[model samples]
Target: MTKNIEHQFSMLVREIRKEFVGNGPKEISTRFVGSWAVSEMKGNLTNIEKFMMGSKEGEKMVHEARTGLVKKIYSDLSVRRKFEDLAGAAILRIFSDIDIEADIAMTIFVFDRPLISKEK
Candidate 1:
C-alpha cells in the first residue's frame, strides 16, 4: 500500500513537472513537509497521535512548513517561472488525495505566492 502511494505520488510529480517544467534538463522538485515531515522526522510518533493533535498545533506546524516551502518555491519560480508555474497547484492537488489535512493547508499557503507572481 505504501509502495502504491509512493508510486502514485511519483507519477503525480512527473505529470506536474511535464506541465510546468516540460522536458528540461533541470527538474522541479516537490517535498512533503509540516507535521508530516515532523512526524517522519521524529520517527516515534503514532499516526493516530499526529492526527489527534489539536488544530492549533497542526496549524502552527503547517504555517512553519509553508514559510520554508514558499521561500524555496519562490526562489525556484523566480528562476524558472515558465517551467514551474503549475508545480504548486499540482502539489496541492496531490495532497488532496491523501488523508493528511495539514499537508493540504501548507500547500495552499505555499502555493499562493508563485501563482500570484505568475499573474503579474
Candidate 2:
C-alpha cells in the first residue's frame, strides 16, 4: 500500500475503535489486501453477559449487535467518504463474524471486494 492508502486504512481502524470501544478493554488491528479491509477486535464483556459466548442467548445478542455495527459503519457518511477515495471503488458489502474462546470476545470485520484498492 502507498503512504496515503496506509493512512486511510489506519483512519478506518480508528473510526471503528472510536465507535465501538466505548469504555471497554479492547484491542484492534487492521490490514488491507486485494481490495479488502479486514479488522479484528477483542473486547471486554459487560457483567450482564460476562460469559456471553458460552450460551445461546448471549451469542444471539452479540450477533445482533455486530449486525448493527456493520450497518452503522456503512451508513456513516464520514466513514464512507474517507474510504471511497482510497478504495477507488464502492464498498460491496460489510459484515462481522465473531467467536469466543477462553472468555474472550473476538470480532472480525470483513469488507467484501471493493473495500480497498485492488491497484496493487
Candidate 3:
C-alpha cells in the first residue's frame, strides 16, 4: 500500500514538473521518511539548460532559476491541495535543489503528519 502511494505520488510530481517546466525528469525515485517524501530525479536538464551548463555564470543562472521556480510552483495553493489530497496529509513546506552537471534534482515534501500509518 505504501509502495502504491509512493508510485502515485511520484507520477503526480512528474506531471507537475512537466506542466510547469515543459520537461520532466527521465527518472524519479521516491521514498517516505517519517513525514517527508524525498524524490531523487535524474535527466532533468533540458537541451538549452545543458548548453548553459558549459559556462560558470550560465550554470549559476540555471541553478538559481530552476531552484526558485520549482519552489514557487509548488507553493501554489492548487498544487499544494493536490499533493495534500494524494498524500493524505497537509504539506507544511517543500524543499527542492538540483545539480546542473549531474542533471539531478531532489524534492522533499514535508507534511504536517506522517504519511505512513503505523499499525498498533
Candidate 4:
C-alpha cells in the first residue's frame, strides 16, 4: 500500500513538473520519511539545458532557476492540496534542488504529520 501511494505521488509530481516547467524528469522515486516525502528525479535536463552545462555561469543559472521555479510552483494552493490529500497531511514546506551536470533533482515535501504510521 505504501509503495502504491509512493508511485502515485511520484507520477503526480512528474506530471506537475512537465505541465509547469515544460520538461519532466524521465524517472522519479519517492520514499516516506516521518513527515517528509523525499523524491530523487533523474533525466530532468532538456537539450538546451544540456548545452548550457558547458559553461559555469549557465549551469549555475539553470540550477538556481529550476530550484526556485519548482518551489514556487508547488506553493500554489491547488497543487499543495493534491499532495496534502495523497499524504493525508497538510504540507508545511517544500525544498527543491537540482544538479545541472548530473541532470538530477531532489524534492522534499514536509508535512504537518507523518504520512506513515509509527506503529509499523
Question: Candidate 1: minimum summed lDDT over ten consecutive residues — where?
Answer: 35-44
Model 3 off-target regions past 4 Å? none
Writing each residue's lDDT as its tens digit, candidate 2 over 6-120 gives 5556556556546664533366555666666665556644455555656887778866675566577667777766666566666665655555343343333344454444465
Q: Per-residue lDDT for 59 in model 3? A: 97
Off by over 4 Å in 2: 1-8, 20-25, 44-54, 86-89, 100-120
Measured over all alpha carbons after superposition, the RMSD of each candidate to the real structure, in angstroms, is 13.6, 4.4, 1.0, 1.1
Best by lDDT: 3
* TM-score head-to-head 2 vs 3, winner: 3
What's the CA RMSD of model 3 in angstroms?
Answer: 1.0
- lDDT scores for all predictions? 0.34, 0.56, 0.93, 0.90
Report the lDDT tens digits of candidate 1 across residue range 1-120.
433433333444445434443421122223433312101111212354356546878745644543454345435544334223323332222121112343322222233233322224
- Which pairs clash inside model 1? 20-83
Question: All candidates' TM-scores?
Answer: 0.25, 0.58, 0.96, 0.95
Better of 2 and 3 by lDDT: 3
Worst 10 residues of 4 by lDDT: 111-120
User: What is the Cα-based lDDT of residue 44 in candidate 1?
Assistant: 19
Off by over 4 Å in 1: 1-53, 77-81, 84-120
